[model samples]
Target: MSHDSPLQDLDLAAGFLEPPPRRDTYAGWQRWRAGRGHFAPAPRLTLGQWRALSPRERSLYDLHRTATHVNLPLQETPMSLKVSRLVNRRIRNNALKTRPSTRAGVMVTGWGYQGKTETVCEVAAAFEDAWLAMHHHLHPQPTPGTRDVHAPVAYAQTPVTAKPKSTCQAILGFFGAETKRLTLPELIRQLAASLDDHGTKALILDDITRLRMHRADDQDTLDLIRAFMSMNVTLILVGVDILGSGLLRQGHFDEHTRQWVLPPSQHARVHGLEATQTERRFDLVELDRFRYTTPGQITAFHDHLAGLEANLRLLKAPPGMLTGGRMPEYLMRRTDGVVGLLERLIEDGCQEAMDSGKETLDEDLLDDVVLSLDDPERDALAGEVPAIPGSSRTRTTAAPRPACARGRGRNTVFDDHGPRGQAHG
Candidate 1:
């Protein structure tokens, strides 16, 4: 019988198609090879050779070698989940003791850029998690008249173009009730029935500022708030200082409502842990700008950055490319203690290095990167080099030269260069 084809041979002697490049020289070759498979000695290429690649070729090479795309899970463990739970717990506790005629209310106010939105997000997460826990049988049966009305509600449960009803009817629908056209009193009765069924007692309204800002005098909105309060429901109203200002100045709510201002003392207490401590006792909350790097955290972050720069210098980076242990200092100076600016600086520097094919960044690169990072208004002001337009140049050509410089052709006389130029004008 004929032997099996060599391509399909079984237990046949192996033969090499080509020898691999030596390991020591592979790295240099790999850099030059750009995108064609692993580097091979037969197809040696220089840095110039790689540089000469067409844009498309280079892109393909990058894709084949260094480029990778990942569809990161869009869903992250929501950062606000914990804070939401705490707020929800307070709400539920108040709701349990509240009656249809009496309720406890709290107003939360802070300046803009403070973590008001984040706080609201956290509260929402807590509510969601609480519902999930109960559904999964991890929590005991919810107490009657204290259950969350919104937990069981689905977005698709309502029909399109349905007329708005009483707040109690809305709440009932939230609890998966199909009854429609509920009167105000009937709605309240249903709400009580549902809460009793689910054992939920608390309610939270994030950003009462919306109502205050848009429709402070809208009877329906006012009635809704009043109704909840009358039911003795523990209500937490989150808002910016504007909301508090609005309430105090404009009188949105009646005098019976209590206002608990979050002073600096509360802020300090919440964020006042040692730098190295884990599991912060108080939620470290602030306006968005002040969140990532607190004033207290800045020094430590700078210290770490300095150490990193020093280590890089110790590794003997090229002159001009070397940070000279000044990168951190430069960043600190440029940022002026703004954490957001510092983050953008780092991002811009890294991106510039990648674009320029430079293994190390220089001071000039940092300056350019920082300048590029400036906001439009800042950039406009920062540009000292005047732009000479073509039309301006044409106009200058049409205009007669200064009398003193007429014989000197187009040479500028008042150059401000020295005494000779200065004296001529």
Candidate 2:
């Protein structure tokens, strides 16, 4: 299943109770008392009531506003769920490996600010979160050399000039192993041992692009990764396309090499054992980019905007949120629809409004905040890599994507009072 699958399996919302849904009066703001609830004016309060709040109250309210609004792009749940599924299957297979297997590790690559790191981290965190949620005893000792350790997923970054040895050392350090005294070969062996010892299902290696340049050639580095995975620990590599680095270019050596515990995945191109240089050895799944508009509710920036609106207990919310009607189009132009960029721009705008004593986060403040941000020359999704063919294990044919309704090529006039509209304005 794609990201459209329900997140009930994640079970992430346990223990930390949720507050009851606040009233959505849709027309007012109220007194900004800094108690547990009234940090921001109520949404139903009149405009005059909001303006009457003291500047100190507004500043406090803005702080609360920023706190709830700013977040990583976890709301784009498709990639997160897909990655979790792949990693979960790998972890389970490794834990239950009855015989030798050569299951290749997962490699996730994306450009900067594509939410690759954050999304993978969230996936990694889920293992530990799930572990913590299910365990009755806080101090339960984990079995070493298995995939059921206290921390099932480990994450780290490759050094700027990381060779195989350095990469091993960094990973070893994450395992809480002493790295200063080990030899290079010893480091690699220890890292493998630690993965089994700590029950780590997968090791997430990020910023590994520099490893290619760290050496005059990347052959040894590729061999190092190959050797590590041969030990049966799944490695989820994250970074840019190494292009011809051979890190993700070569398939399995022979039929014997493919006998490891994993089953073949016909839908994913990465499951092949041996491939030509022209063939991709690793599957490429680009992060879901936010669209200016979408026809359906499955994964869109509109959902993200709706989430932000739900959390603002004490901050002033505008009539139309960041997703309302024309807002996504305008916001996409200002921030290019990157989650991090969008959040920063919104936070800055909220701060500016509170500082300027503006009552609500409106189009005026947003326009001002984006003035300092670089302007978009084209559509936010421009230059995105095309979806790879036969690379999705659970991808299904669906309805064609909807046309964005806010931009050019569509025109209409909305009468002051009704839902009916006139086209070709």
Cα lDDT tens digits, model 2, 1-425, are 12432221222322113432211110110011111232222233344544555665444434444454443224545445675676556555564565556545666654444567666665555555555556652324465444433545666676655666677776765655688877765676677667766655567777555454334434455556555555555677776543333344344433543321222222122322223212212334455445544465223566777765555432355655665766665565554555556666666766676567664566556655532324342111211222211101212443467988875663323101111111110
Query: Against the true structure, candidate 1 has what lDDT?
Result: 0.37
Span of ten consecutive residues with least summed lDDT in model 1? 416-425
Name the candidate that leads on TM-score. 2
Which portions of model 2 miss their true places by more than 4 Å?
1-62, 71-73, 78-81, 131-149, 242-246, 251-283, 292-299, 313-315, 370-425
Question: What's the lDDT for all of these models?
Answer: 0.37, 0.49
Give residue 239's error in model 2 in angstroms.
Answer: 1.2
